[model samples]
Target: MVATTASTGALPPDLFDTTTLVSLAATLVLLGAGYAASRQFLPKDAKNSARVLFVWHAFDALIHLILEASYLYHCFFSWIPASSVTAEDLGSSQFYMPQPSPFLGHADRIYGPQAGAIHGNALAKLWMVYARADHRWAGPDLVVISLELLTVFIAAPMAIWICYDLSMRRSRANVLMLIVATGELYGGFMTFCPEWLVLSENLDCSNFMYKWVYIVFFNTLWVWLPLYAMYVAISEISDAFAVRDALAKVKKSN
Candidate 1:
């Protein structure tokens, strides 16, 4: 069945409703609590901000692997029915059809009009909720999907490892963070710039939640935070090199 529409015939409640706001608020609170808890496990001399950074990376990794991966899985795999008989029963004669199961297909029917329903699964339905909120994501943009797949599968795991290494004061952490941050910065720009250049008609900057929260906050966070992480990585690398250079000079002089 199609997703239920709002009574006013404007949009579904899940599109840009209070649930989105609550989810965002709860996420922020959970991140804050995680940071606070991380601080207790940190070295006594650790900087206050380091705890927050650790938690951020940890959360980033979790989101990439769990949330983004789920989206990606549903994007590709959910199209294939569990059983051939089910596809045949659904009126498809093909053996390997790219269609959602009966239940998700019903959701697709209900919610598909609000946003593009590429797959007929709960995850795809949830994806459409965000899509309806941000017009930029209203369709199944293959470019965006490919980028997300790379980010979720490759970059996210790297971020998780970097977080662990940084917490343990590993020497390679800065270099790894530099790499990940560069990828993030590039990914953020690529995800938006092409669409903007094409004069995207799908962009739905109608209100505060869609314009500011979903589009601005969600996208820019990757840009700004990754930029900052790159800066930190560079500074740390520079400092280490400077220290090594000084030590080498002193040894030569002696």
Candidate 2:
């Protein structure tokens, strides 16, 4: 039942390959749910762009609330002993441990973000599947956790607000989209830039699914979507400014 690997240790990918397929189906289901919601929640008069934004933001918010939040949960509550001797003393605590454990060097204490597979924590395994792509997901990596904190608590609510604004057809939706999009781009950059600068030591890109689908394509969405949002926001704002200038000229002429 080992889920994550080539991170702290090399685990058999074939054994857990089915987990990847299952999680992929679930992710698609989550994404489809967002689009379905747009039909119900968005107004008929709403533009196609609004509909797309609504679906994307809704999916983003849910990811923060559901999947990412679950990661935080395991980080906070899941535990495994750092010391082999401590693990022995704990007794019955080691039903399914991570091989080449991230916590092994620390010794004498419990560490987490690696939930026990014995408990049948499907969500943890889902993350572990992704952790195989990026080691940072397998343990308590500070940068990832900090970025996720903002992503979950702050970005999640902002994304929800954007969805609400899009549904309501409010001008503030543009502003919110601009803000959230900027934050997302910044988060995406910070998440990977350092790793890139350090030659991507924490990343495993050997697998096609891990490299193309999970790391590249998934991360690219944040970049592309946010850039589009920023464009929309700036365009609308510029139009507003032009209108204001035209009105000022009319007043002076009168």
Best by lDDT, which number? Answer: 2
lDDT of each candidate versus the true structure: 0.59, 0.74
lDDT (Cα, 0-100) at 32 in candidate 1: 71
In model 1, the runs with Cα more than 4 Å from the true position are 1-22, 29-37, 80-125, 136-139
lDDT of 1 by residue, 1-254 (tens): 01122334344345545545655664576567557646754566765445555676776776677556766665544443243234353331112112333434443421221122333344444454566444333333556677887899889889778777767777687788788888888888787777667664445555555556667787787877777777777888899999999999999999
Q: Report the error of model 2 at residue 249, Å.
A: 1.6
**C-alpha-based local distance difference test score of model 1:** 0.59
- lDDT of residue 128 for candidate 2: 70
Clashes of 1: 5
Candidate 2 weakest ten by summed lDDT: 90-99
Q: Provide the TM-score for each candidate, comma-separated.
A: 0.73, 0.84
Listed per candidate, the RMSD to the true structure in angstroms reads: 8.3, 5.8
User: Tens digits of per-residue lDDT for model 2 on 78-175?
Assistant: 76555443445333222222333334354443443455332468887787777766767766576777899889999999999988888877889889
Residue 209 lDDT, candidate 1, scale 0-100: 58
